[model samples]
Target: MVSYEGINNARPKTWATAADEWHALAKYSLDAAKDLREYGAKPLKDNWTDEVGATAAAEFAKLADQLEAAYDILLSVNMVADGMTTTIETAHSTMRAAVDLATQYGLEIGVDGTVTGPPPRSRTEAEEMGPYRAQVQDLVDQAVEQVTAADRLAAAEFAELAGQTGLTDPGKALNDLQTHASHVQMQMLANDIPVDEDPTTVRQWWNGLTDRQRKDMMLAQPVALANLDGIPADVRRELRGNGKYDRVKVVEYALANWDKGDPTDFGNNCTNFVSNALLHAGMKEKTSIWGTSDDDSWMIGNRTGVDGVDKRLAYSDSWAAAENNQNFMLEHGGSEVPRSDVKPGDII
Candidate 1:
């Protein structure tokens, strides 16, 4: 029979660590229980004592139950830890990408002499600031999208693994993963080390724009106005009236106006507009928009005649695994976008 005393003494320091240990223990327990059953049955031919046989049978049954419980705990702990690891790795990658981008754009240093390696260099002259700010903002926006995508992938994988492990209650496993991922993401956002661009500086620069300059900038990009169907009518109107909206303001508008109908239904018009804006600004063709909802439309869909098709809906039941389907979009150039190089339709 399996040794209950040994098993009880083998408890781990933490639930996750314990789960790992019990996973191995559970397999060993099952093997031991099987051996005991076989040995007990073989002695039937000898007509063993009733008390001894009953004890053996009861012990084996108890071991089997214990093994099953241990297996469940193992699955739950693994799922939670896996989710946490994925989120942490994704956040680190995003921060690195942003920093790299900033360095490329010459924004590697702050006015106070602090090193901010990845953003583009600041444009000292007012005339040179707008485009430079826009470029930097675009890179930041892309980084945010990538981070969000990573979060979603982590969540989905955790859920799938939990189901595969034959856990008695997979819902708890999924919830734990979600909580862990959220906590990691929140920590990353809170740090705000300014990898690609500084939010405060960008805001100040935007506030300095002249009405005419803003109007000219707004009028230059027909793509954003025409294609962003997901944008609210009022916000779209505001954008149309003055092209000088700051990068953050535009993103805020997009987020605020996001349609909630379908979780994965990336709205057609608005996504295209955002994608096109990035393309015009020299962002790589693979750059995508990332968000939690179905309609947030980054680059995961198939395009037809310059418009993206709803592949999720079109192939609902036949969807490929996420890892096999979507290519991770890494930042191409350095973090900061220079003001002079900023295209009118640029996202940031």
Candidate 2:
């Protein structure tokens, strides 16, 4: 019964704090386990001789096992809490973004995940609103259902470990066998996740993973995970999509197109050249249709079409002036890198 309002209001910071606490507990447990082995278990095994000594050794070994179990239990809790923090944050950000898009289209998502469009005055208005309503509904529904599943999946996992004492006695032989079997099981799961699969297939597989498995798989196979599509939308947004920003293309365009022989290139055209390189590097044009064109309009405006109208008035101000271009970049996917950290093919 989780809803739009629940995710929208959830505090990710608190989850982060909880994760930190669990990590601290795990560290303490690990220290205790290590201490038991070093100061207690080892010494007992090394010196224990005959009947009484052997009896004492057996009891101490059991204690060592319990301490190791305690460390493992705490570590598992820490890992889950850490992973859940990321999951909850992603859910919150995605849900809020969906809500914002819904609002943008004059639609409202109810607390129970219902999409309500604004009342339309005419049949034409109703027709226009239909697609937007459907889009928002799909987005909101997917976001809600995915997050709910993740939450419940994590809850179910936690339930299995509930009330189990971190430091408890368990007489066992399957412990070592269990560990090996679990490793094999996890490896099998990892192998089952297809490599170089179509993005749709990859996304579907990723969506089916529990939150724990997602975190574990990412840690275990980062290179494969990096190649896969459908990473968290917020993380993906930070990247220029599909490796579109190619430095090689930027350099190539710069070398081939650098010239003042054209009539439009009267004098300095550093930003113009940069804009051309950027276009070759796959930066999309933001003409008046999209934005960054308040002064005048030029069809297919940029360096390639700079000669069509007045040179100063022909192109995007962002496509010509260094300052304007920098500002536009900052507003877009670009970041203000420090001078010392600036790399080649980066806008100066």
- Candidate with top TM-score is 2
Q: Candidate 2, TM-score vs. the true structure?
A: 0.50
- How far is 150's C-alpha from truth in model 1 (Å)? 12
- What C-alpha lDDT values do all the predictions have? 0.40, 0.59
- The sequence of per-residue lDDT tens digits that candidate 1 reaches over residues 1-348 is 212122223222353454366457546645654664566544542455488776766665555444444444454444444333333333334334434545665654232222333333564554464554455444344334434444455456556544544333334433554345444443333222222344443233223334543343244433343344433355346553333333434443444444433323344444433443333334433322432123323333442423234434332211222322222222222234678655433344
Candidate with maximal lDDT: 2
lDDT of 2 by residue, 254-298 (tens): 556665343366357687777777777786666676333563321
Q: Model 2 Cα displacement at 151 (Å)?
A: 1.8
Off by over 4 Å in 2: 163-348
**What are the TM-scores, per candidate, against the unseen true structure?**
0.30, 0.50
